[model samples]
Target: MLGQIDITRRQAEIADIVQRSGFASVEELAERFEVTAQTIRRDVNGLCELGILRRTHGGVEPPASAGNIHYSTRQILNLAQKKLIADLVAADVHDGQSLAFSIGTTPEIVMQALTGHEGLCVFTNNLNVAFTASANPSCQVTIAGGRLRPGDRDVVGRSAYDFFTHYKVDIGIFGVAGVDEEGTLLDFHEDEVSARQSILANCRKSFLVLDHSKFGRTAHVRGGHIRDVSCIYTDRPVPQHIQALLEGSETRVVAAQDTV
Candidate 1:
């Protein structure tokens, strides 16, 4: 019986499952581990104590409130959806347009998608986006001066915020960690949040690119208000409440799957 497994080993497995799926109900975890619900609960409680998982209403999920997932991990998760969202956002961009990109996996994908576009001058705090956008010989890339965050490979600080204040762009593309029920955009870093706020304010048109997983998630910093975005390009429909919120604010919603 799986009941004979080592408690420590089983707990690790549970952590992996919760991290992978984002959330797992106690009953589901219990069945998978071939243990009683009480046993699974104990394992989950122990993991929670260790801060490996966070308890949810009926289950447990990865500890996300502290910060964002690692950049490497985010790059691999929901990859297909990210690609689709990128394509949708890119369609709105044209040659000779000035663009501003925010730091995020989805924005990186958008940069890759724009690799061949000509006469584009891009400004960004994301090193990866700046580098990728520069791959198109005709595109000029500008990096904002700020405190470089090696882990996320992005720059953010008062300097980055000041950098964006000097010029307005034709389009601003960004990704957020979460869009809560109240239609607030949120992220994990204070400097990054401030940088995005500057980008949004300085751009003529602002697009928010995100996968469906961002819905209902939580991030500690307030990025901005959803009403400020010109349009949202996502792989799937946003939550019904969010949709209504956008409509009321005169923001457009582009569901990539439906468009294709």
Candidate 2:
């Protein structure tokens, strides 16, 4: 329960966190706004429902896309880092390459970076991704048809999955919510796992473009082991043990920011 003044202040505080940190947590927000955790939860729930902040487990991150693409309770996150990684991944693409891009912030960056590449084909379930790629004359892009997610411009569900079954690509690239000690990719939804599995099965090669913070973490659902991927592009030098596990599984780890 919160007094009117307290509630107003907390809401503004949550907005401030989203505006500044790009993400913030219930507990941290509670402490900052000098309110109870329950009050923060209420604010977060209400604000997310209102499209003021994106919410996530323990916190919130920025939406990958704005407008009709807002989904979940997660707040803003790691925009600069995501952009950096996107530029790096884009550099790997060339003319006449086909790529499968998934629905994630980093993938959005990759799409932006590829706007000028010629003769590129992009297959994506993310409407924004497909739209972004299509804008570049260099790309011939197709979107997977499915029920669109409210918060994300992703066309998830049966139709999209079925669409994926119809085509093969040179590479499938995506970012995961987490990476495990066993070197598996993990996420928050089973359908996403299923979609990625289909991508892995169909693509000639696959890539996991992740940031360092994702290493040694686990989300609610398991995507697959690292070896299931052809390569992992990341921004950090992985821990020795994680590096060894990746090597053991024959998954090449490419530090996206590495000068070499």
Clash number for each model: 0, 17
TM-score of each: 0.77, 0.72
Runs of candidate 1 exceeding 4 Å displacement: 1-66
What lDDT would candidate 1 get against the real structure? 0.84
Top candidate (TM-score): 1
In model 1, pairs of residues that clash are none
Best by lDDT: 1
| Clashes (candidate 2) | 17
Q: Give Cα-based local distance difference scores for all models.
A: 0.84, 0.72
Q: Candidate 1, residues 1-260: lDDT per residue as tens digits?
A: 10011337678667667777889999999999889999999988987775567899999998875467766546645766788988887788999999999888899998888887899999998988987877688998999986888767888899999988888999999999998889889998788899999999999999999999889999988877888899999998888888787765778889987897
